[model samples]
Target: MTGERARVIVVGAGIAGVACARELAAAGVPVQIRERARVVGGRMASKRFDGRPADIGAAYFTVSDPDFARVVEGWRAAGLAREWTDTFVAYGADGRRAVPGPMRWAAPGGLRSLVTELAAGLPVTVDRLVLGVEPGPSVDGTPCEAVVLAMPGPQAALLLDPALADATRAVQAQQWTSTLSAVLRFPHRRWPDFAGAFVNDHPVLTVLCDDGDRRGDGEPVLVAHTTAEFAGRHLLQPTAAAAGVEEAVRDLIALPEPADHVHVHRWTYAKPAAGLPEAYHLDDDGVGLAGDAFGEPRVQTAWLSGRDLGRALARRLTA
Candidate 1:
């Protein structure tokens, strides 16, 4: 490792962390991103399935805030994003209903592409698990000027230094349900009206999507997500539970039989019902906490929290 000390160390490479890093770097502050995962894009993510990029995290995010809309505009101009649809289908106890109006956007390659684009000019160190933070100096003896904990509140609490634990404890962390995402490729398309559906009150399935229709890729891919309750109950037995989920998805979408290929993914901290105190929380030592947990758990909230932290950090560094 280099003997040089970074002006700031941002933990986690999710949207919030990347945004904070980008904002800090743009302000001429030397920042380094340490991520536990092999690649960036904490939750707004994707992976290769059957030679095609499939989004297993956030299906698609909406641009509601003006500031976030500006960022989305930039992403669109850069060819990293495109409009998926303005209409959505909701599958509840009453059956499937088409709802039209709001504009929805998606990345051409996948959701992870957006995070990669945001981190283009930032220095990100992947596969570095930060067990905890120490007072005075880091384990390497590098006196970090500032530290940003940009992960779920519980995860952040685990890594907090003793000095900050009590204060941070007041910032209530809610219990969130998990999700199991199954990506399947089909020979022919199933749904007609919309690209996705919100299956309600089901035992195993929650959402199902026609990937081909959404991305205009012409390849039939079905992505099914398990409900939070179901995921938590069967997280350990994925292979055994996946068979039942596959069967449930087939029944929901009216598929003749099981899909061609099925991939199961488990997200321990999928969403947050409650959030931290503020958009950006700065400790007495100039350290900050930012992420989806800091604000609303939506994609826009994550971006907004990061932007807010970036602006705040820039002001602090300039002062």
Candidate 2:
């Protein structure tokens, strides 16, 4: 697909990029997705363990927008996703308690599969890292009619051409939080039956997910996300923090001790501290930004932001 570049080039093959490309393609505009990773699904990621795949990033996603609800409904009907839970157990120095929230959703093939499904048939160029864009809106020296950066604020800001210096500073002003995801596998199920638990006031752990129950087949695995502070402190040496996270996983879930094996993943930009108030941004040159950080850092927000940008860009191109 990279043999011939299209008029519109979307950098990043995550959900936002794919969704934007799909919309542009539907509008009779040719677009191609360029991703640095071998596969898509930025924070909505999954990786291999011993045999099966494990969700190492973004334990689950919640839907709120009516437009996003319709999208979720279709995914539900199509078997791309399922309701994970609405209530999660909250942890304190004292004990465990339940907290009710939005209906959380999960995918059988890990959250990454949903992005893969959404991007089906879309032209995606993987392992293609973008250096930066020229003011001509060129991507890595390849000129294109437009370029859509579907990534976090800081990462996107690095690609801004000098012509968009003001926008770059604005983008740079945005803040993001890092995360360390640890997935533990057990010889047998030993933890509580809760869907997920929120670890509060913990120095090491922040959130935990029962992967077995989540995947719908009931395999013995647990996924834990660490506090932003913890992740930042151990960003350079993520493994150094794994021992503490494992301890929390055991105690927070009322387990005896550590699991059989573990896998650790670091997210340098896991989530946004705050997103831009707008749904999307497009300078006069059609160079734009779309992602969860463009609005709210959620799965639905990413999709909506991308879709909205696509529609906006389509109108601009068709006009």
Please estimate how well model 2 matches the true structure, expressed as its whole-model Cα lDDT: 0.86
What lDDT does the true structure give each of the candidates? 0.79, 0.86
- Candidate 1 to truth, TM: 0.93
- Report the number of the highest-TM-score candidate: 2
Model 1's alpha-carbon lDDT is 0.79
Which digits, one per residue and each the tens of the lDDT, describe model 1 over residues 26-79? 887888899999999998878897678988888888888988899899999998
TM-score of each model, paired residue for residue:
0.93, 0.95
Clashing pairs in 2: none
Cα deviation in Å at residue 175, candidate 1?
Answer: 3.3
Listing every candidate in turn, what is its Cα RMSD in Å to the true structure after a full C-alpha superposition? 2.2, 1.7
TM-score (C-alpha) between model 2 and the true structure: 0.95
- Superposed by TM-score, candidate 2 places the C-alpha of residue 33 at a distance from the truth, in angstroms, of 0.4
